[model samples]
Target chain A: MSAQSAKHMIAKNIGVLGAGQLGRMLALAGYPLGNTFTFLDTTGNPSAGIGEVIVDPENQHLAAFLDKVDVVTYEFEHLPVELVKQIEQHKPVYPGSRAIAVCQNRVEEKTLFDRLGIPTPAYRVVESAEQLAAAAAELGCPVVAKSVTEGYDGKGQAVLKAPEQAQEAWDSIGHTQLIVEAFVDFVREVSMIAVRGRDGEVVFYPMAENQHVGGILRYSVAPLPDLDPSVQQTADSYIRALLDELDYVGVLALELFQTRDGSLLANEMAPRVHNSGHWTMDGAATSQFENHLRAVQGLPLGATNAIAPTCMVNVIGLEGDNAALLAIADTHLHRYDKAERPGRKLAHVNVVASSHAELLEKVRACQALIPDAPPVEWSFESTL
Target chain B: MSAQSAKHMIAKNIGVLGAGQLGRMLALAGYPLGNTFTFLDTTGNPSAGIGEVIVDPENQHLAAFLDKVDVVTYEFEHLPVELVKQIEQHKPVYPGSRAIAVCQNRVEEKTLFDRLGIPTPAYRVVESAEQLAAAAAELGCPVVAKSVTEGYDGKGQAVLKAPEQAQEAWDSIGHTQLIVEAFVDFVREVSMIAVRGRDGEVVFYPMAENQHVGGILRYSVAPLPDLDPSVQQTADSYIRALLDELDYVGVLALELFQTRDGSLLANEMAPRVHNSGHWTMDGAATSQFENHLRAVQGLPLGATNAIAPTCMVNVIGLEGDNAALLAIADTHLHRYDKAERPGRKLAHVNVVASSHAELLEKVRACQALIPDAPPVEWSFESTL
Candidate 1:
């Protein structure tokens, strides 16, 4: 794992945007590769507890940051596209500015998906309540209306059972523009993570079945036992297309709906490492964080194959008893060092085992130790 | 994963003595467990390169270091015993001060091995050249004479091929006290690492066959294919006795030599993590670094079972082309962020595979890419 692109590798100062858990993990992975990190915190509330952070609430320290780092990569996608574009002038930015631009707006993301022939739920961009109702009528009932920009998790989203509720949904989601999508009746939600190096080499991890509670990911299990090889190939092809189209130089996660017809419909994609791929930390041959750093550093990507049947159980709000959780076999705890609060992601537990049954058992044992953890359930359980 | 012994886990500030690569890795492993680090560097030059370093050239910042940390641990065993003893009064130190005291003096270490009924090479502690010659004559030719107080990595030591060379060996060692031991005719060298928790429970890793060049560890392969199950049991029992005897609560490594008759002889032991156990980072279920932190933090020790056949190649003196090395499948690089110099350990690569045959193939491929790497050879290759 080289830190810089040279005949002989040398330590590089990696500039990171957004000081959150993802940045913290990136620094942890990058440090072993002989790289240092300097985080640019825009909100002045950096949670990536480790590393040197620059509080740049007004973006006045951009020149200082650009002068210190050899390359720049972001951990969070919500950063202003202009900020990333400006940094690109002084230092190389992985995933580029187009990635941030498209990911910031759902309409742009969907348009690219449509142009690239990646199937997505029927959708239309609307700016007013009347247009939202019209789009709902055209797409049919049970549509999800979301603000095109500045929406994550379940924020700024509303479900309209009928076109008559469009006005109420529009009022609830306080945004200038919205993307109304017809809800797909799917069997389960799944995501595939891929990394594309600077040399245009791409690698994909096995699809992970996701279980979300209140739109926040609760659990993710990789190498789904019931997943057909064709389905995996389809996912790989979909993400490969996205990676190449964006010329992505880091990890990209594509979330999809696995319908009963044995087809995948693209739901959304994240330009950076996604929560659904955290299971790779212990389950895959190389973690997503490490692969992301490798790609950003212009190094060859690592093996993406799953090492075993693994599950990631998110510890949200309240944390579990650390000693009790670690006492469980094959459980690895990763704490964010953030104080406990309702609806906050405090930590996650990675459970790995030789078989899916054993993995589920360990996951259940792990979940029992977490305080206020959602019930452990997976769509592949019945197949197993 | 708990940082303290309380019912609920909390982020702890860990105090580490000796800021070196071991301490850097300990902090890397500890950060995920939701702990912060503060290092006490007795030497002005600290190679840790990370963490909050308190350089106390005259022991002026001991109070500040102690004030910020909850529990204390040492990465190097050669620290001043009185400094550790003083730190013990303010904070709990894992492995205790007695472990350091015994490890610092070769005579004390050998005597403890004898008291614990651990077999060792024939040896005699000598104070003068005349006594050294008598001990060499008694023990036989080709005896190793090492300074009793300070000797490591073939330093402060000399080999006397004949009794008449005792004066030369004594003069070379430059110490008032020396321990002379007869060399053993062994099949090969091997080591076993074990971690003991605060509860007095012990877990041992599978024996790793080690290869050394100029007394510095060059390579180590774990879960030796030809090793008898009884041999592993013997090594485990030996380390377990040592751990309990010293009331040790951290990772301890014991080097041993396996004779042609399939018996193990105790060579020496390290109070902290050893170079031979670095393979555990990728090969075992739990790494030695994480286990050491867990033990020091009063948490339960993790599983020490090897996940696959693994080999660790030390990057000494020079570094390999990072891109070429990482191009190999299942190869993991961990650099210490140090400038390359003669006889310096810059980094290491961990190669893993499902079977020993495949692992050997990969290890050979990985070695070819490293600059100045020794030829790849393994004791288990013939068995494979």
Candidate 2:
């Protein structure tokens, strides 16, 4: 398209709602494409420490900021709803506030899924201690208790292996509103990603199996061939239904559980680019970062095919020999410049290959070089 | 490696010989891996104008510039050997002065190749107008005449379809020093990329099929499967012989010709990262750019296995919308930041994929979205 054709949609700058690694990566990706990135953070956050960091949402001319750029997008779902609403007054904020609201609350997300005829773990809203006791009785003793709002990477969520741990989990959440879900007896945890444009066109990347540990993503592998076709379809349906209901207008991730019975259940939805989609950087035709940019910019989505069976391993907080890790062949490591602390999201590497097995071998090789990492576990939940 | 380990290497901040796109990219890639980049171009040639554009290489160094960094490497072959020798007293140079001496001139490179028993196109010395005439007659009517000391990208070279074009070619070259070679009827081009650390262990990447247009590199596809095993062996032998002959270090590109006789003939070599290796950025085990830095730093050479079947297309003098091209998925365009003009290397986009044919389709699609570029014809000399 010519500049004249793009003049209608071209905003002078983009106001990314959350200035974290995702936003920083988006900024990096967009900057070279000649797009200006204005970051939104709590002002003191490291993401804002480098780029055009904006803290205050009020008393600023939203019009001027919107006027300078095209549209607004966020890297994380934790952006304030009021700020999102305020930004909407001036320009479109996508995946819109509704998507954020639904994705932000596990209860609301499950309720939406249930209403949309999408399969989710048997879940119930827990209002208080008494409600949790009754809900767990119905759901099961080993059920998971999660705060209805604002939880990610295993925070504000706990497993009730026994009734003794329920109070601890409840007290840990400060008795906040929570959702009790029957733990899935799934064989594999996987995710499906899609980019939804304003015109309602959606492009889905090949499904990927995710492995998580300690509520943290440890690795993600694509074209999850072990996944049953029915499960894959069900996962795709759940994601599309959620996006359709929320009117999502960017890349969204649907975390799913492929049960032992071959049934796929919706676990959660992320409104923005999710960690599971990081493999797209080297594996798929479009990276989640670039696709999010294109989706929010109202551009045509590119091909959503995996060029290879890809594995993305998060370089969680380890100050290993940087040269050693980087010297690995065909391994692309992306450092977020985060301080290396135990369990911190420091950097990530995407390994691409012709097959999932080869990618796993690469992941193993690369992970071996990453010093101080937790021992490589072949767990289903933990993924990087 | 720590500062203590790096200390023994006599950390010399590299003074790149040329300030062009290669230098600019070399700087961008080198610095992040822990080396500082200083260029020789004055007033910052617009191509190398991306980051901390070093405008006066000499005065800038004494102005406490060299204090911050260690070691030096050249981006191109034609870096004045004398200037490099002058800088040698201050910082160590990789690929060394010997590499420059051998690669900068066609006569010298040919002599070295012949001495090493490498097969090349039939040729003879053409120093003067009379020499050009005699050489053409001996070689045949249709020949390629190139200045022995300076020629590249079809510049300083001409094709003689008949003897009449010889005098014009000589005049075009100013009849200073030239070599006329019998133009071989080759089918395609391929290149072998290898990196040698100070220890002399050569790590080679899978050979790539090179496709060129208008004498400028347009695309390179890796893992050229059609190559005969014997020819591939010969190519490796040829590179090994050249590196040994030059006592070379760092990443080097060996372009070859796949003649009708099914033999690989010597074309030329780039002592630094060549355009054919751009796919390595996202497609290789270790990028040529990073490996070059590693080799220059006296570090271990990396594995050269390709992660994907990748194709790279150069965006030359684009008149279309930058945002349009930038929005495309899987597109990595490296703009030199030079003022867009007719026939200048502006930017290049690498489309990485698993299937060779699929990557070509995307390249064509991207080429359509970007500005008009003349169809680059692939001769037997692009990668070969």
Candidate 3:
């Protein structure tokens, strides 16, 4: 279709189910494109600073909020699928409830990956302590046990070092439906952000190598320096299969484990804009937040090519001087207005440079100003 | 001082006096930096679609709005000086009331240019029909007569083609305080945007060559192709002197007329972000809007380097398919969400390219989508 016709079809008002940093960034990205946002959160504080926030507890005010928007999408993937289904009855919700339902359950997510021939660790479902022990024995002595639902940020999961610990792990998790998998020996963790539009157009951002501390992402570097092409290709094929299977119409983030032999194994997926893609705000031709809005709004997707080498470091529980962060040359600081709390993401800094070395230097300079931030030295070398 | 100390001093909220496209753009830029905006206008529709707008009629409710923000600034330059002075009593206003007071009148503005050694077209103040005739005779025929206050976008001004038209021009303008000046026979119109920080740091963006139709700006091409270094240096010197003189703490724009002999003549000045600088949103490393916020908040200034050759075309009185404009590659569209009128500025399209030739191609492509837009072409070649 011509650009003119496509733009006339642009959604005037977009709705997000959750109001957080992702929703705030989405509103910020959509503002330039002439889209207003109405967010439905438990409280008004989620996106209160950026857009209109409607408090809708028990889905009582959902219909009224939906009436004000043309389309609906969610920020966090853990929203109740039934609530999204209720919204879908009134208006279209991008990445639909099926994708959200599958991602909410570890077993369902792994089963979909298996059906699509995506590479993943060996896994088996367990319902009770006896089943958990058997599954751990079958997978091997060391395995990761994850609950079927409501798991995130290293929560609702446990690692079993031996068969003897299987019962203990299951008991600790309250014996919910679980998936036990043989842990992969990975060299590093990386993620790729893919956007699939309503017209079936798909674009993938370069993989971002990530670092996590205590299950929370601490930093990420895009275009994963010295990454093997075959590894990226493998990850892309899996993302494509998932998008096709789910009929996805927004950004889908796939996290993978890069093994020592440069092979990729799917770890998980996020049905919305992911933290690893934050660097795109400064380093890419278009940001993931903007592209996500385009996909959900059914507009033409923007360029996803990286414009520079970039690194993003999350500011967790921040109480330092923001002026110090803004002082670094070429460093873009994003501070979410949420109150600071331990282990909560308060802000992030994206350092962009014409070259990887310069980006690293600036990233290190930014890291020095924030307390408790991890050191800024990368283990990989640039191959580009 | 260390960045930490500087960040600790960052302002929490900002207020804009007028909620138009300029204020909307400023809010978009400041959003990522964790700043919230409260706008005060005659009605809510001006900045209604974006930030919170407080209706303050007759400056009766100005103090209540001022109490909600940390610092205050404005979008339009023609705001009443007395009203701004009243707000200044409670909270700080960037670019201050003094700059606004001078720029609101043509005579005071030209006087400042003269005192700062900035070359301007030869002009004389006119208070009556007799003085108007004398000034036109002294400056020769074909002079421009402009009302000293409340004139913008070609309004409140008239050109006297012959001595006989002097009385007619004076009567047409309603005999307001005016300035009659020798008409500049220049090669082209250009403008420079300079941002001054609270710490006395000043940075100038590359000059933009502007095209105006009936006094409303139609398009702008940045880095002003084939611009002489000395001309740029002269413009910079003038901006620096003005910044120092006004103790300016935000973005200030100086529009100039380039002569056939490569000399520059000052035309006028704006105390806030100018329309010509809109291209910086997609073309520069840091947009003028963001820099203006940084200046007001007392944060370190961002980079002012151009990332590519860029051109911006205003979508005046638009009533067409926005999709066509968005379809152009590397084109950034900003719609102000205002009701379209016969000649109102509804939106703008920014086209960025690696080469000037490519930029013109995309700019032309965008122009073709908007109804009644002027043809796109650059008469000058790049000197860099």
- What is each candidate's DockQ, to 2 decimals? 0.60, 0.23, 0.55
State which candidate has the highest TM-score: 1
* Candidate 2 lDDT tens digits, B1-384: 766333323233566656787876675555434344666555345356433445664555433434433677767677678866766677677888888877888898888888988888999987777778888888897888888776778888888887767778889887488888898888888888888888787887778778777787767777764567787778888898888767788988999988777788889988888988888876776678878877887766666777667767777665445456545555665556555687777777777655656665666677776566544333422333
lDDT of 3 by residue, A214-257 (tens): 89998899876687787778888899999999999999999999
Give the least accurate 10-residue stretch of model 1 chain A, judged by summed lDDT. A2-11
| DockQ ranking, high to low | 1, 3, 2
Between the candidate structures 2 and 3, which one is better when assessed by lDDT?
3
User: Can you write out model 3's per-residue Cα lDDT over B1-384, one digit (the tens) per residue?
Assistant: 665445555687889988888999999899878888898887545744677888765557677787899999998888878878877888999989999998988989999999999999999998987789889888998999999999888898899887778788999998568999898889889999999999999999999999998788989998766877888988999999999999999999999999999889999999999999999998887899999999998988988878788899998885456766666767777888876688989888888877887887777787778878987645484433
Predicted structure 1: clash tally: 0
Model 3's CAPRI class is medium
lDDT of each: 0.89, 0.72, 0.86
- Please list the residue runs of candidate 3 whose C-alpha ends up more than 4 Å from where it truly belongs after superposition: A1-9, A43-48, A137-141, A228-231, A381-384, B1-9, B43-45, B381-384
Instruction: Score residue B164 of candidate 1 by CA lDDT.
Output: 96
Residue B61 alpha-carbon offset, candidate 1, angstroms: 1.2
lDDT score for residue A262 of model 1 = 79
Residue-by-residue lDDT tens digits, candidate 2, A27-139: 54554344567765554454433346666445365555566556888888876788789789878888888888888878778888889998888888888877887788887
Error of 2 at A179 (Å): 2.8
Candidate that scores best on DockQ: 1
